[model samples]
Target: MKAQVLIRPKAGILDPQGIAVEQALPALGFGGVSNVRVGRLVELDVEDPEQLDAMCQKLLANPLIEDYEVLTSS
Candidate 1:
């Protein structure tokens, strides 16, 4: 089955990519933007659905500074 792991910074964490995007918005004519939080899309195939949560907890995110969500059969 397919799974997607989305890792994002925890609240109160500094997001450099998000900051960069926010600064660039005006240059790209998206002046209405204020804040941006950057994240990623990681797609993978897993043999066991039950392992999905464990996978994220063990390796997908840094528990101290990041948060993650897993999408199953994606």
Candidate 2:
């Protein structure tokens, strides 16, 4: 099976990169863009579905600063 993980900064956490992007948007002529948050997408092949959470908890994401969602594709 193929598993995909979407990891992003938790609410109330300062996102410097996101802030920078949001600030630069208007200069680049991209308007009406608000609340631009940056995240990561990790795709991998897994033998067991249950191991996905463990992988995220251990290495894929930092639970304290970020939140993650797991998606499976066949």
Candidate 3:
């Protein structure tokens, strides 16, 4: 199976990278863009699809300050 994990900072958490991108957008001639956020995507092949959640909770993301979503495909 092929799996992808999308990891991002949780709401109400301070996101410096997001802020920087948001600010830069306006100056670069892109207007009306707001609430910019930065996230990461991790793709992998796994034998057991059931273990995807465990991998996310244990090492792929920091549950305290981050949120994650897992996607799987055959």
Give the higher-lDDT candidate: 1 or 3: 3
Candidate 1: worst 10 consecutive residues by lDDT?
54-63
**Whole-model lDDT per candidate:** 0.86, 0.95, 0.95
lDDT for 42 in candidate 1 is 79
Candidate 3 wrong stretches, greater than 4 Å: none
Q: What is the lDDT of residue 42 in candidate 2?
A: 97
How would you encode candidate 1's per-residue C-alpha lDDT over 1-74 as one tens digit per residue? 98888988888999999999999989988778976999877799988889888777887787788889988864
C-alpha lDDT of residue 53 in model 2: 95
In order of appearance, the predictions have TM-scores of 0.89, 0.94, 0.96
Ranking by TM-score: 3, 2, 1
State which candidate has the highest TM-score: 3
* lDDT, residue 25, model 1: 88
Where does candidate 2 clash, by residue pair? none
| lDDT, candidate 1, at 17 | 93
With a 3 Å backbone cut-off (N, CA, C), the pairs that clash in candidate 3 are none
